[model samples]
Structures are given as structure tokens and as C-alpha cells.
Target: MTLLDGQVWTSDIYVDGWRPGRGEPWQVREPATGNIIGRVGTATTEDVAEAAAKAAKAQHAWQNTPYDERAAVLRRAGDLWNVHSGEVQEWLIREAGSIGPKAGLETHIAAQECFEAAALPSHPMGDVLPSTEPRWSMARRRPVGVVSVIAPFNFPLILSIRSVAPALALGNAVLLKPDPRTAVCGGVTLMRVFEEAGLPPGLLQMLPGGADIGQALVTTPEVRVVSFTGSTAAGQAVGELAGKHLKRAHLELGGNNALIVLPGADLERATSAGAFGSFMHQGQICMTTGRHLVHESMHDAYVEALASTASHLPVGDPHRGEVALGPIIDEKQVARIHRIVKSTVEAGARLAAGGTFEGPFYRPTVLAQMEPSMPAYTEEVFGPVAPVVPFSSHEEAIGLARRSEYGLSLGILGDVGTAMEIADSVPSGIVHINEQTVADEANVPFGGVGASGTGSRFGGPTANIEAFTETQWLTARPQIAPYPF
Candidate 1:
């Protein structure tokens, strides 16, 4: 009898207003105790195909509907998100063992995305081209076809609905496949919110299952666009499938972000800023500052200071209402982090601070004297472990930071001159000066490059809506145009 139980969250699959028996149910686990969160209905290959077919069949009416109609449903969906915020908050905490400020972020970010998307105009894509004043020049953004939203486990709510909602706003039907591990907490309830918003049957459906369901959705001809957020390996697979089928795919993948702290930088400011990126979600975010490149002179002092600060970060149950760090997502993740840490130690890395775990909880750990060859430094640990690698020169620090195959995110805390210089040169999508790499406000474009991800997200209303919609250049030929001049 381990910590977790066998029960799971259960939900009826909604297909054309009929609750059908989709074979095989999922056992959603509580990450902390590894107990049953609930058994959500799992979608089979056939179930997925049927759902896609239904969406394709309904696409005509769905896409033709007015933007106001679509916006109303989206706004209503936000209301529903609040209605279920309590339950969702619980799921996020249980699934990710998300603690303190991080746990609440899921609820607020999801609600913000929904509420803001709901307010977007149906036809904001206007027409203009001042360069050619005497000629007809206009641009417009139109709805793409059906989309399959495959989201990752970390920040499940933040990533999943953020992508799907905008697409829905643009009059596109969607089939969202959330990570099976987080189906109950983030996945199923998200769909319930859409349902509560009175979404037209078949306009949006959730298929919560394993890779089989994902493959089914991607390969299905009816799924015209595929938007995914997950590991780089899985992202490559999805991209390949989309390419093979000649379909549009948007991928938000993994990262091994780096944060550089120069000699003259404020140690407290750098440490505090970097802490949120790696500690929040237990460092599961792809854009988190997973690597710390400290100036050689400050290496020892910074490590000692960071270790002391990290040790004091509270650890406990997410529901306890304390500023504590919760466990990683699940048991396997717990073991994976263990192996990475062990391997890093074997490769000559030193554990500077907390590195112990009971159940799924791994106390926030700090590692130093790690080479790029070490797993913890090179690979995406996806845990609260920051590998502090020191660099002698400014050039070397920037070089080490940009040397990765990943260019997802980077940050610099130093003199304004060097920080800005590094921010400009860092080969990442988002760069922060005097701040942590992963601190993305909702209104800015957020994503990565290389193996990191293909798109971005922001905090503002427009930034929020771009994820789900595609740009379509619409033109208007004059009703009565004169002959060529």
C-alpha cells in the first residue's frame, strides 16, 4: 500500500450531445500521495476519429457563425472557469504538487486568458496599406480549420485552454487532447467549462488518453491544425505527423534556459528573480531559468547565498495555504529527477543544497561545479534543481549560455550594459535583463527557438488570442473599379 490509491476522475464523453461509452478509462493520480484523483473517460482511436469527423462535419456552421456569437461563448467560458476554479486549483496542486504562488498562478492565468479572449472583437483584422494609397490594399485574419490541442502536464491549464480558446474565438472547431497524467484535474474540467459556456455540440471535444489518441488526432484528415505543448521528442513526432499530412502545427516544447549573473550584479536580486523560474512548478516550465551562469568572482558567495535562501523555502501540501514548494508532478518524474541528480554527482557535480525526497516531493536542490556534459546542466531536469556553472569572462558567460541546442529562454542580472548586450545576443525567443528567464507577463510574446518551441504567448488580450487563431489576408476588390491606369 503506497501513498496513492486506485480511484480516478470520471467524465462522460460528449459527442454530438450523446454520452457514448469510449473504451478504456484513465486513472488520474494525485502526484503527492499517488492516489486516485478520479477516472476520466479515455478516448480510443475510434472515439477520436469519430469526434474529429463530427467536428469536420460541423465545421461549416461553426466557422460561419458570427464573432460576437463566438465571443459570447468564450466570455461565458471564463465565467465557467471561475465556477470550477476551486476544483481546478485542487487538481493543479495535486497534479503538479504546485505550491505557494505557483499553485495559484494556474487558476489566475487560465481565467485571465479566457476572460481576455472573450473580450476580443470578432473581426479585428482590419485592412490597410498606406504605401500604396491609390490602390486597394487590405489585410485580414480569418479562421483556420479544425485544430487538435495537445498540451503538456506542467501548467496544464495555462497551456491547454490558452491555445484552444483563441482558435474557438475565430470560429474553429477543436479537439483537445490533454496529457493523460493530468486528464482529470486540468483536462476534463477545462472541457466542462466549455460545456458550461453552452458550446455547440461538436464545436469542442476533449479526448483524454495516451499517445494512441494523440496519433489518431494528428493523422485524422479532419484535424487540419495541430497545436501542442510538451517535450521536444513528442513535439518532433507531432511535427513530423503534421508535415507528412501537410497540415499546420504549432509546437511549444522544452527548454534548458540559462540565467547569467555578472560580478557587479546584486546577488539578492539575481537569486530572487531566478528562484521563481526554477522553483515555480518545481522548474517544470520549459522557459524556466534551469541553468545559472555566475561570474567566477561571485560563484562561491552566490552559491552560499542561494543555498541558504533555497533551504528556507517552505515545503508542504499545496492545500495548506503556505508559501511552500510542493512535490514534482508524479512518481516517475520523481524517479527521473533522482536519476539525473545521481548521474550529475557521478559526473563531478556537487550538491550545494537540498536534494532529498519523500513521496513525490523533492526539496528544492542546488548543484554547483557542474560541467556542460553533466545531465543536470545539459538536459532538461524538469525539477527544482539549478546547476550553478561559473564562467570567467563576459564573453564566456554569453558563449556558454548560447552554446545549448535549446534557445527557449535566457536572462541576465548584471550591469545594464552587459545585461542588455547579453539580452540582445542570447539565442532565445525571450530574454530578460536583470530578471529571471521565465518571468513572462501575460501581455508579451512568450515562446522559444531551436528545440524549445515554435510559437509564443503574452498577457494582453491580443497576445492571448493569437495562439488559437491564424492570420488570413482578406482583400476587397472594389465593387466597381476603373480600368487599369
Candidate 2:
């Protein structure tokens, strides 16, 4: 059941010991422990080309399947996932290292969103231009064919489902390349649900592997579009390949999102929110509130509150709900967090609470007297550490928040009018008022600008309707008489 030495992991990928030669195996390490949980075939460039070729050969027939039929299949898959949510939750905790509550919520949300795809507009309408001579023009949304999904380790289940579901509903066959760490379990579970729900064989496939596999999937000639979510460096790499191959790609990458607390901002609410949000999952979240812009007046109070909250979080096994904080994804990620914190302190920021982490056990930390040029300040600190920067004026606050490669999400806590203005000025695609940057619901258009990400997810109509479809313009000129002008 485990892939090793470049072997395939699932029975689904083979018939009588047959496997894709191009997919050499890759390792999956548990984030909490640097232990190898499993291994799976990592697709080579040729493997990606072969898979895309298969999709091209089979995609048109799938695209012809009725919308209702596709919708029904996805709905049943949702039901199956709902029933087995606990098992999936266990896998998420074991692999991704998120605690019980967050993991459970993610599973619930990801599973339900599969059904949400059923609501996607099957027949995108085009209207005729009002003309006296009855000359008509219209447009239609059609599948682009062979959509490829490259998901991240932090959100292997949710991101994978979001990208592939909409594309599948719109009638494109999807090639899923999940993050190697949390890959097989969640992905294999959902795809099985779809198969049981009546998705035809070969219509949906999940290739659980690593970077080599990902490069294969995107560079394949037959893949019309690719959707990716990960680090900025990886995004740039993948984005480049997709462009060179002339393939469309949707990217959701890194972020160093900001949460500002002004003079009149709710002190109690902001502090509690800052702690829970920033430390959640040890801050391995893209939209985690890393930059805290506190007004000079509330600066001390907010930092103390955040520190008090951070100090109390218990870290260990994730299944316990009271354990509030769990391990960071892995030891390597722990090392990165250590380096950033060390660099920040060396660059003259004072640590108010936590600063050291061992293995995956990162202490929930807070820093005051921060400098913007520090790695922890400007880059995405994907760990359970929060840095507090004081601003003398509102204008200065906004200016400080804008300094990041990530523009994923922003938060403003203050008077409603001022909050709206701050939200409008912030460059992120998604904004939250009187809330943390990670406060997103099921179906809101969520993405970012700059290095954060390229496309949005959870779009109620627009995103769901157009994520994987193409538009064609149709024109009808009054039946031009035979060969007459």
C-alpha cells in the first residue's frame, strides 16, 4: 500500500502490475516528525506528457456528458466524504500536523465544496446584440480540456478539490498532482467517492508524488491549463513553464498578510483574534496574519494580550481540541522559522514571548519594536510567530502594511468608515474588517495580488463558472443572400 524506491502506491494506477514508467517514486514525510509516512511515484516529464496525452484522447467524450449527470456524481462523492470525515481528519492531522478542530473543519469544508460544484452554470449564456436587421451575436463557455491541478502540502485536500471540482463540472478531465507529504490519503479517498458516485474511469485521476511529478504535469503538451498553489519560488518556476508551453495556469502562492489594530480598534477582540489566527496550525497558512500594525496608543496593550494568549497554548498531539497549537508541518519548516526569528532578532527586533522551536514544536511567539526589512517582517513567516510594529499615524500604518511580496489578504480593526478605507487601500484581493486575515467562508472570492497568488477560489458564480472553461463568440449576420455582398 506504500510506494518506495520509485514504486506506485495505489492499485488504481495499475492493472496487473503495470505502472507509468515516467512516475518514479518520491517520499512523503510527516510534518510533525521527519519520519517517512509513505512514498509514491513522482511523475517525470515524459510521465506528465503521457498523462496529458491520455487526457486529450479521452477528454472530449467526458465534456459531452450532461451537466446533471456530472453534478449527481459529485454530490454523491460529497455524501461519501461526509460519512467518512473522521478518517480523513485523522490523515490530515497525521500528515499535515494541524490539530483536531482545524483539520476537521478543513475536511468538512473541502468535502462539502465538492457538491458546491453542482451549482456551477452548465450552460453559460450569451445574448444577441439588439439590432434592427435581426443580426445576432452570442457567446458560449466551453471546456478548455485537460486541466492540471498542482496543490500545496498545507491544504492538499481543500486546494486539490477546489481546483479540480470546478474544472470537472465544466467538463474537463483533470490531472491532480497533490503535495507529496499529504498526498495519497485525502486525494485517494475523495476520488474513490467520485468513482462510487459514478465518475467514469479515467475522467478524474490523482497522481500523488513530488516536484518532478509536478513539473511533468505542467509542461505536458496536452494540458491546456494548470492550477497551482504553493510557495512564490515554486509558483514562479511553474508559471514560467506554463507560459513557455503556452498553457493557462491559476496560481495561489505565498503571503505575508497584515492585521492592523488602530487607536479605537477593539483591543480584546483584536488580541484574541491575533493569537488564534497567527498561531493556528503553527502558522503554516498562506493567509496567516504575520505583520501586525498597531497604533502607538494600543501598541503595548495589544502586544501584551497577544503574548498572554500565545504563552498558554498547549503543543503536542493534535487530536486534543484543547491543544490549541500543534506541530509545524515538519522539522525543515521548523528550521526555517528558527532562521527567520534569529535573523529578526539580529536585525534589532525584541522578542516579547516565543522565539525558539525544536523539531516541530515551535513556541507561539510575539515580537515588538520590529523592523520592516527583517525576513520575519517582509517575507511570509509560515510559523506560529507574530511580529508587532507600531505606527504613529494611520497613513504610516497603511504604508507599512503594503510592504510585502504577498498581497493575499488584509485585515482592519477600527471605526467602520476608516476600516473600509484601509481595506480599499490594501492591495490584497480579499479583505476582512474587524477580523483577522484568515477569516474566509465557503464561497467568497479569495486570492491575492503580487507574489501571493494568481487566481481566486470559492467564487460563488464567476470563479466556479469560468475557472476551467473557455468562451467562444458566435455571430449570425442576416442570412447573407447567396453570393451577394
Candidate 3:
């Protein structure tokens, strides 16, 4: 729905399965055109507390719900997702500023997560333990009660669903706080889908606001777990709050990922992968290849080929034809990227391809001969800019990759044995061979290490074990023993 000039649509914040919010409204703007897409209700602290208490109350009944019923609800939600995918995809493009391909991938992954989580109830729960005494002992996983999910604007659907689905599947209530910029698409849409799928009232809460709401959600005592996805600094704050309350925290934070191009690697394949890894969605992804490490033997040729490939990538309006690169999220992000590019070039790096912007659109950029001390090389440049550095030997390449504090994902292009060796040595959570650093399959764990995140995986069915569950040991005495008092 396009709003006329001076008109703004207001979307309410969901609490206790209803919109009881009367707080100030936060304006949601389309990054591509700077138009008012909608206005999301800014949840107050009281709203968060009420949501938490309601979720806790709702979880008491949900936890005891039959496994079959829970599975059916999730499956129905998945079905609804497919039915409304066209509309949801349009929302993603408009709200999150995602290109067509990126939006499709995110929507597909969100639906798949619901389907995967649907099977969590039927999966193996616990194991029996051999006991020395005349007793039977076993360990089983149980729901952690209420969980809080804080998602970022980029890939909002997938990030939120990855945690929300598992929490729901494990019979835990969820309070999701999506980035306010994407409130309608990521928050209201999810709540509607579950509600339409016969999910009980109060089982899920959707609050759209700024960091205050996120802080309130994490610090709420009734929230048993906090699953957060955003910048490293924000994740750290959430982790601290979770720790202070002794609540379980699962974090997927920022990443300055690296993609290595070896001497004998397929140049065409490497170039294509590098271009996609660096420029997709204007490189807002956490796992986007921020650094391209090339072996010195092929550094010059790789730089030229990569620059040529990146330059040809379609960049403009997301609603237009076959756009490979979309606008940066906002003016602040565009300015930050330009600053990084300018500083890197001043520090002796060469700008190979693109380094300009028209409105919010930042052309795909390549910086070669980058030193480790350069900000673009060391920091997470969350934009369509790849800083290339040359490594003379295998040891140097490994050292260069390891020098960063973020060990989220790594890509190495080489033979199988060599790739395996490099992958084994790298401290990243995900390592791809002959591929880009960014890849998210539904069945594999997706997260990071060190400052990148809290080292918790958030994908596949196993995600249920990460943030929404706790292990309990139960024992039965077969023979009664006399107690000495």
C-alpha cells in the first residue's frame, strides 16, 4: 500500500496477542526513496514487562501442549508463508530495502525454518544413563520458558524466524523485537501468520521500537533466553544483560569475513563468487566478504578481473530490473562506507572499481593493496566494498585471515586437500571451499566465534538446543535404601 504525500500508516506493537500500545510512533521510511512506508508503535518499558509476563503465563499451557498439535501449528504456519510469499517478498523489498533475489532467499529460508522447526518435537529428546546404584537415570531437554528474539533489519525474516520457530517448536513463548525499520514486514507479518495458523493468544509477542525496547526485552526477568542478531557492540550489551539476569543468550553478531583466492584457483568461478559475496544487497550481510585475500602470484590478475566483474553488476533501484546491488540502508551507512573507502585509498590502497554513490545507492567498490592497519581492512565494512590484500605464502595468508578479531566465516579457493587443511586451521565457525564466505543452508549451524558472536548456532533443528532449552536429569530409585539421620 503506497501512502500519499503527508500520509503515514501506523502499525501497532503486539503485546499479549493484541495491540494495547498507545506509545509514540516511530516512522518507517523506505531507504530507496526516503518515503514514509509506515509508522511502528514504539513500545514502552511497561509494554515489554507486560509482554514478558503474558508470555510466561502463556508458556505454561504451551509447554504441556501435545507434540502433534505443536507440529501441526508450525506446518500450517509454513503453508501460510508460501501462500503469502508474494506479498511478504514485496514487504521485504520495501521495508528492508532488499533486492529481488535477496528478498526471495530470505523468504524461502524463513519458510524452511518453520518447516524444519516443525520436526523438533519428534526428534530425539534425551538419553538414558547407566547407574551404579539401584536406580534409573536419564537426561532430557525441556523448554526454557519464554525467549526474546532481537533481529536486525537485514534479512529480518530469516533471522527472526530462525529463533522464533525453534522457540515455538520447543514449546516456549517468544517475544520478538525486530528492527523498527522493518516492523511491518518482520514483526506484524510473523505475528499474523502464527495467529492465522491457530497459535494460541499470548504465545508470541511482537514489539517494534528502538534499543530501549530491546534492552527491556532482554532485562525482563520472565524472559528465560535472549537470541540477538545485530552489530557486535549491541550484541555485547545484550549478552551483558542476559548474563546479569543469568538468562541464556544466543548471539549472531557482526563479521569481517575473508575470501582467499589461491594461485591455481578457477578465476571465473572465484571472480563470480567474490562479486556476489562483496556486493549482494550492497554488502549489508554479516557474512559478506569484507576482505579479499589473494595470493601474491595471482593478486594483480585477480584484482583486475574482480574489479571488472564488480563494475558490471547492476546497481540502482531495487524495484527495477535484475539489480545486483541495492542502496545502503541509509545516508549514515553510505557516509560510513565512503569514509572507509577514502581513508583506505589515502593509506596507499588503490581504488579499483567503484567508490561513488547516487542517493542511497553505493556502487560496488574494490580496494587493492590494503594493509592490515587500514580501517576498511580491519573493521567490518558493512557495505559493497571489498578490500584486497596480497599474501606471499600460505603462512602469511593464514596469518592475515587470523589477524582479525572476528572469526565468523572464511572462504578458501584451492584444491580439496589444501582447502581442508586451511579450513581446519582457521578459527571461523564456517569455512567454505571454492565458494564465497556467505552461505546459509537450512540444515547447517549458522553463527560465529570470538567477537563475531556468542558461539551459539542458530539454524537447522539443532537450534532448539541452543537458546530455548535446558537439560534436566531425572532419576528413579528401584530399591529403597535406608537413610541415616
Least lDDT summed over 10 consecutive residues: which range in candidate 3? 1-10
lDDT of each: 0.77, 0.76, 0.86
Tens digits of lDDT, candidate 2, 1-485 = 21122233442342112354355555666666667766655555655566667767778888888778887777777777777777777778777787888878877877667767776745553455565555676777788888888888786678778777777877888888777667655455556566667877666667766677788788777788888888999999999999999988788889898998878877998898888769887888888999999999999999888888888888876744458777877667888898999899989998889887766788999998888888889878899889999999878988998887678888888887888887777788888888888865556676788998785754555876666877787667757735656
Clashing pairs in 2: 6-25, 24-42, 31-329, 251-454
The C-alpha RMSD of each candidate to the native structure, in angstroms, is 4.2, 3.2, 2.5
lDDT per residue (tens digit) for residues 208-293 in model 1: 77898899889998877888888999999999988999887778789999989999888887788767767877777888778999
Q: For candidate 2, what is the TM-score?
A: 0.92
Q: How far in Å is the alpha carbon of 107 misplaced in model 3?
A: 1.2
TM-score, per-candidate, Cα-based: 0.90, 0.92, 0.96
Q: For candidate 1, what's the RMSD? A: 4.2
Clashing pairs in model 3? none
Candidate 3 per-residue lDDT, tens place, 121-191, comes to 88888899998877889998999998899999888898889889988999999999988888777787788
Clashing pairs counted in every model: 13, 4, 0
Candidate 2, superposed: residue stretches over 4 Å from native: 1-24, 34-36, 121-123, 130-135, 319-322, 455-458, 476-485
Candidate that scores best on TM-score: 3
